[model samples]
Target: MPAAYQPPVAAMRFLLEHVLDFDAQMAMLPGLEDVTSELAEEVLAQAGRMCTERLAPLNLPGDAAGTRLVDGEVVTAPGFAQAYADYVDSGWPSLAGDPAYGGQGLSRAVQIMLDEMVSAVNVSFGLFPGLTRGAAEALAAHGSEELKSLYLEKLTTGEWCGAMALTEAGAGTDLGLLRTRADPREDGSYSIIGTKIFISSGDQDFGNNIVHLVLARLPDAPAGVKGISLFLVPKFLPSGNGTPGERNAMSVGALEHKMGIHAQPTCVMNYDGATGWLVGEPGRGLNAMFTMMNAERLFVGIQGLGLADAATQAASSYARERLQGRAADGHGPVPIIAHADVRKMLLAGRAFIEPARALAAWTAIRMDVADRHPDPQARAAAHADVALLTPVIKAAFTDLGFETTVLAQQVFGGHGYIREAGIEQYVRDARITQIYEGTNGVQAMDLVARKVTMEGGEPLRRYLALIEADIEHAADHPLVPQLRDALALLADASSVIAAAEGDPDRLGAAATEYLHLFALVSLGWMWLRILAAAPALGDTRTPRGHAALARYFAAYLLPRAGLHAARIAAGPGPVMELDEELL
Candidate 1:
């Protein structure tokens, strides 16, 4: 049997109820009044049970079996289809979807937690719903009414799955240079002819159909990205009454032989004169796709949280049970958990994970407020927070997640590197998160160039102010002073980035470090929030333990903030000065 995952239920509950206060926020939303804390807890408990029982058993097997493309059709690992069916039948897919379209309309925060658990149990399987939710969000926000009626309910209910078709043979991040063609048809649809690479869940056998949200260029369009358009293409073209009718002119050209996530079919999609309807206004595909990309970015961050949490659970469990060298006290051979290095590794995992979970949930809560908050200015501010933090969440969470998993694998020594312990699977799975949904480098550049410097750094200032308020609340703690100093560094770095607008290389050099600084500060803020809320709890052990972890973060992890700030302050001078051909 694979190492069992002990779901961090206590920590999740603490963050959701105490720190994020999602229940209180939900009470104010129009349709979320019914989503009480007790109900949400119950929902999570059931989902956790489903993951442990249904999904956990499939992880190793799925990894071993992988996905196969036979007879020009993609087939998932054994038991995956049934697990997905169970997931949908349980109303899990509709957890945060539109109620008007047969969804439950729960708060997005609930979905965030659910996703974290599901992903921990099975990262490959999680990608199936992850992509669908993104595609559905884009369609719900930008799709025409007719398109909504035809596809939204089905996608929300998991009757149909979805894919984002963006990358091509010659283009990845630079979509402006893509050569895909979308010719206008007399029937108001377009003939989408393109070959898109790195398409997740591009084709699957479980759902009734696959819905694709494709990015392509239309004829008579301008020279660059502004000319691109978004289209809705499906595996099977719909009949007049909305049933799967004729076969669409699209096929999975090949499956990517990837380093990880073997259970998911990452495809090279060939769209040959496929009939597709235009989504949103003409020449505004990026605008429409951002709705999906932003959502996917957050979901991808949660994937990091999931894999890291799983590794933490497995490695810590092993450390407590696996017999190793003698303890420092000269006791007989004991479990490695008694060793200082093992304890440090486990603590580091906790230090990274708990705060990341809080930030992810907090960001999702902001998304809710951005959409449903009563005050206009409050909504705008919440939306800005979402924008500023989205990239940080995506890049930092995945990067830390990959690091945490490797640390966990090291805790197992040689066994961790092999497939038997399952820790290695996480390392492989976590690698992709950094590369997809925009590379971490691209995300950092976006944070510096678009999010931070956009609008003269008002958003960054507002975010720092929130951190200041939290710092004041925890002023008595020893870590407060350090956080305060780091916050200043963040402010200084933002101003520097904003001022160096004319120098692209300088901006590029500082972008990643600035983002890491921002992530550490954000995580520090979350740690403080958790500490503040811990005192109110009846049980003191959780708080006391978390307090220790918070101290560990401060003494060790937070120091990296200063290192990143130093890099940021140095600008791109040293980096740019290096000769291209130097050894």
Candidate 2:
């Protein structure tokens, strides 16, 4: 039995083979010569098994049982430590970490598929490793060479764990409001003293030593975000023999009991004169932190993808098993899945997840290029693509993830709300994706403000051109005639936003709508492209399923794209004009 989970592998296959052109990615990445379609399927199949058999089984209890906080230590859910150990032993952790640092150094698409699998299986578990990916990315990008050698290897191998400490009670969204201080010591170290709240993996027993990447302001520094600096604040001092010695002055002040992802500790950390080393130069900490934060944002968005996958799978399973009212044309009391409305809901869920998965994977593939392209210009182009797509991947995947998870819950109807049923966990787990790692609203603002206008939409223009090229390449193929049309819809959405002028409010209100529109049309593009590549998905000959998925999105979901077009056209007037006390 497949259990209550959707097979993201099939979707992943569609993406890798058809949508992303996986073989091309393998040709690009060194040591990925073995990543043929057959190998890819086996990898995805194993991922599905591990996630479904190992992780999903623990999620419900993990939520109900949660993590134990005793004496300022967070003990993750049952089987978590062991499962993670097994997962590490399996080499999954190294999928995304740099090759120089004991990682597999495979394409980002591989990592995204792995992430989606784990997230779909158990979100809390997803956090523990997901944080590592962010931490490793930061270290690789900004940390000193010494820092990279010391931390990246251990963190990469899962011998050590990592957490980012950026948020304070006063500075949740606005880093400018933070009051943490870092005074440079006579040596190369600094003395960090501050309070950080909602720090994930701040204090955990999962690894030997937890590395806290803290953000603080230096003495004589200017005010606000510009004044801040980043520090390597370890939980305990690293001794000469790969062991932990003196306890660093960082502790968990409190732990939160949240609505979801309970086993993933949400902590208030106190850094009291902790010995710290600067990762990058002072007054540039925000810039350095964003290196990690951007990666985290994308991972968090994938968290959304994972939960939605779980929800849809769970709902789909329940729908096929649960006897419900017959379809108007069918025999009595067939499975709910036999009904037209249930099919609609399942299709709706797919409408969100399939394309989002493709996009996330595509973004990851680009990451490989950014990180490893032999040429500087090619690397820069990859970096630019990663930057431009990061917000869209984060925001669009998550927003759709929430909707799909809810629909999954609805598929189960009354049972989903009950804890024993376990469907609610997906709902609860997915909610956090929208809240943390830069709120979806923040993501929208970044998309509209920083990503779009700042570049004069050149980045977006480049992405559109790439899509255009993909359509042109696939034009003569039987499965690709519809791709150009999808590209046109996506192009229109991008152009409308790119075309918008001086009216910030006009741009702002429409920002969310535009992102949604872009996501759908983009997914439509992904679907068509992936469909063309379906031959690699064990059999591209069956165009029926892929075509139906495309049609479902095109007919039903694309209208939302149009709706967003309307909202974007309306500008911000209706949204901003409302007075504060209307409620």
- Pairs clashing within candidate 2: 6-313, 18-530, 18-533, 19-530, 506-572, 534-540, 535-540
List per-prediction Cα lDDT, in the order shown: 0.89, 0.79
Candidate 1, residue 224: the lDDT equals 83
Of candidate 1, the 10-residue stretch with the lowest lDDT total is 535-544
Cα TM-score per model: 0.98, 0.93
lDDT of 1 by residue, 350-386 (tens): 8999899999989988988898888898899889999
lDDT of 2 by residue, 272-327 (tens): 99999998888899899898899889888888888887788778888889997867
Instruction: Give candidate 1 regions above 4 Å deviation.
Output: 540-544
* TM-score of candidate 1 on Cα atoms, chains taken together: 0.98
